[model samples]
Target chain A: MQITRQEIAGMDKRFRANFINSLSGFKSANLIGTVDMQGISNLCIVSSVFHVGANPPLLGMIMRPHTVARDTLQNIKDTEEFTINHVNSSMVRQAHQTSARYPSDVSEFDAVGLSQYKSTLLNAPYVEESKVRIGMQLRSIQEIVLNKTELVIGEIIEVQMDNKYVLEDGFIELEPMNGVVVSGVDAYHSTQIIDRLSYAKPDASASSIRGHAK
Target chain B: MQITRQEIAGMDKRFRANFINSLSGFKSANLIGTVDMQGISNLCIVSSVFHVGANPPLLGMIMRPHTVARDTLQNIKDTEEFTINHVNSSMVRQAHQTSARYPSDVSEFDAVGLSQYKSTLLNAPYVEESKVRIGMQLRSIQEIVLNKTELVIGEIIEVQMDNKYVLEDGFIELEPMNGVVVSGVDAYHSTQIIDRLSYAKPDASASSIRGHAK
Candidate 1:
């Protein structure tokens, strides 16, 4: 369809939100993380999380513009540390509860019935019930003015995972965790391993299509 | 299980690889519009892009990092204009081939098999095939310390997307596009629609667990 610039701009504004909604619709789990600042704790749900770099071990998450002060952003800013916990089917409901914006002084950990555990190297606490947790240090923060959003980049400092999800080579198979994927907004979807393509760089040999279709 | 700082760091490094690998798995489609001080033209392709916004939209992507000497980045520096297109299933193959690294003067539309269109306000071009795109003006360029990485961030000026993908009240419905999800290093996963969640604001009304099964 021929979409104009105005149409596109209108759609761009809702893309992430709709994607998140589509994602949440599946009743799939959302990525849940906990942040603590000066003893104030908060739980935040994010779906715009993605890896930014590998060499420096970085991950980036785009946060919606905060209409009010947010504990997660405040915590990260204050402590320069945070924990990322992978949400699975088991923690979907509790994770949803954590999305509630409680007072900065209140702990979402208590509201969600999630146990907070001290991170290995960071001052923040992670969700004990989460199947996968990674301690990260703030590396950068940039504002997306077009959307008035914030992108948080964190360098992975540590990782905690249950062996059941780890492969022999240490690859974390998120499948069993009932790993949920987010769409635009408010949507939660489950991930199914459809096809595992061979890793091929642009300089490498093109993938052999024969016997490779899953 | 408890994880140590050193152990977490080790896992963090490896997980970083997997995370980036997963991102690489999904092909990114964007318009490489060029302006030779006067005219603007759009080119489309799927690149394994990365974000460098250590601060706020200080976004960056690893092109051939060498490709910068060519047209896109050159144009951005000369005119400080560019755009980002988020690819969906419809243009998967088209976006994939746009990464062929054509000569500075060669347009991917001619090199690859995709069509291009001009932008409205920006002098750059937009991929007719992409469903969503962000128009930006160049902010800065930084070369990675030891790697052939060129970090580029632009001020987002415009966002484009299809109207159907947009819902009333400005929510984007991304599922119909059959948005392709990425995993590993080259795997492209198709999405399935599920449920949508309400925005998880501190005071947003709590979602009902009526249909949810733990």
Candidate 2:
């Protein structure tokens, strides 16, 4: 089936949301943890996390700040800190539960029965169950004009993970941690590695690096 | 192992790239097809494609326009059109090869041996081997002042896919299309669905809606 611009603009609101979202393909399932001045912890699932830079260790995520994620964006702005914890397959159900519209007074961590682990350097709470955890400091917010969504860029202040998950070459293996991916609006997925390929070159097809190392 | 901001900044540049890149979890693997003024197809791999909004069916991606992706960015800026194609497990090697630094005069489509399927609505070329294809028109470019990279936002002008991949609820099933996710910088992995979950609500744990249907 082929859908044109005019046809897409005319799609049912909810259907168009699911369809357009899926077009972006698989996304990182991360539970972004934050806290207000009163210390009411907020945890919400975000799928737009993408690497921005490395030397500064920055990551970026897009959020409709005025909608379901208003609290997350607000908390980050007030505290200038947050924790990004990867949602694994085992915690998928609980992670998805964070999206529910909870009142500002109620902590999603308490509502969903997930433990909040506070790191030493940041006020943002981390998911104790997550194998991969990152603490972020708000760097910049760019307002998207066409859509009101804001692009939140954060600098990675700290990264905490198990030794087994971090390989010798600094590549963090997700399979061992049981990391899960999100598709469209409400679908979750598990991935199977197809072997890491060596750096590409114009002269030849890339070769699989055994165990991600030479 | 726990890594702090200071340590990350001091690590080897390449090592830091691999380490920090993995912290974002998984990303969508896409082969972006664009063409020059002379119709020389430029295909490149990008993992940063993300859903911006649904009403206008917008998608956004991050690219370092001044670097390896200069050709693709230049073509899109000049022509204001591009095709974003899913990179399945089978074509992952070819997709990765597009990242190789090719001369501006040479088309990556010719260098990589992928057939270019031109859609009537846009000047860009699509990958015939891709099961999920989307034609995008440039909407706006936001310069990420933190890094030199620019966020390219595109309106989803057209979508083409098999009927089977499009569910009744409008969720495009990527697993059926053999869609793969990328981690770090060079690793590719195929996904397995864990079933779509019901929309979250405050009252209960989200139950899996079998086959993405109620």
Candidate 3:
């Protein structure tokens, strides 16, 4: 159907605004700093975690647009290091608190009361309470011209996760982690375990369907 | 941890060949071709649908990077036209067949056996089997570097959905439509309907909670 620009803009304003301002549509623990030569620490809670590639195990997170200057963005760019911590239900409130606009000098960990630990290979800190934390080296940052948003891509350097959450093969049990799915904007959600279907492939024959019959 | 280029390539190859290749991703329903003086049709499928903007109702999809000669991509690019059809569970097999590398002169709808209808305002046709079809105008075509991927961004010009799937507010009820989620290189997925949570926002508070609760 024919629609005017005004109609399209009106329909999208609310969803767009919510998407930009909301925390993670899905909650993952994000650690806030890098370790210094003297063991100094910095911290922030970032919610833009995304898997950019599988082969090299790359992960990405978009920092809030650098309105003034952002510490997490700066540290990742300067030191080329950071860590991603998966936020479970227990860390929801604390993670929310980290999204607050604090001064550059402030430590988000101190503000939100979460313990930090050194990353295995990277210079960044990992959230001690997180069920899974991944250390990464910044790969590249692309400025998405359409929206002026920075897409920060990182290469996975090392991974550390609580064994309890990993399956024998590598499937992650996301339910117990209380992974949240973001919707309209700033809401938090707890996911329920639904049926986990067997993997399906494009060329698999009928025999492959047997495993999923269960 | 420091990994050699060999290791990276090995992991990338394995991930692309196995893990990603074994999953079920989306196969989209797309219609192409301009209606002649007499109504003739050309319809097909594209699996690379993606979102480009929240504001202005923008969306994007990647076409065969080498479609330098195919009529589908050419028609969309030449006429600056196309429609997006959301493939429901019922259309899975037919949708899959649309991907066959047919000659430009052949219509997949005839080859795979499906029907097509004209879009309301746009020149492109719409797959009759699709539950949700959106007519869009080409905004830009960007070629991704180092890859045979062409990112076609579009502005959502008009949307048509089964009334049953449209919710009280503007939120589209995606469950009944059996919305397919795409991943990796090639696959088809039927998503399990998780709980529909309230839209979250950064500014959410007890007062806003009460308002939504009502």
Docking class of 2: high
CA lDDT, every model vs. true structure: 0.55, 0.90, 0.52
- For candidate 1, what is the TM-score? 0.71
Model 2, B51-108: lDDT tens digits are: 8999878999998877679999999899999999999988988899999888888999
Tens digit per residue, CA lDDT, model 3, B1-214: 2333345455545343333221111222233333332334455555445444566556555565454225566676667877777766666566655655666566667776677777547777777777666777888776643244455667767666665543334445444466543322333444432333333223441122312322
Q: Which tens-of-lDDT digit does each residue in A1-214 have in candidate 2?
A: 7999999888888888888899999999999999999989999999989988876788999989777789999999899999999999999999999999999999999999999998889899999999999999999988999888899999998998986777777788998788999999999999999878888888888898847452
Judged by TM-score relative to the true structure, which candidate is superior, 2 or 3? 2
> Where is model 3 more than 4 Å wrong at Cα?
A1-4, A15-74, A84-117, A127-134, A159-181, A184-214, B1-8, B12-14, B17-50, B61-76, B90-115, B146-148, B162-170, B182-214
Model 2, residue A199: what's the lDDT?
A: 82
* Candidate 2 wrong stretches, greater than 4 Å: A212-214, B212-214
Residue-wise C-alpha lDDT for candidate 3, range A48-129, written one tens digit per residue = 4544445555554556465322666767667888776666667666665666666666666776778887744666888787
Cα misplacement distance, residue A150 of candidate 1 (Å): 5.4
- DockQ list for all candidates: 0.26, 0.86, 0.17
The model with the greater DockQ, 1 or 2, is 2
Say which prediction, candidate 2 or candidate 3, comes out ahead on lDDT. 2
Alpha carbon lDDT of residue B133, candidate 3? 68
Query: Against the true structure, whose lDDT is highest?
Result: 2
TM-score of chain B of each: 0.66, 0.97, 0.76
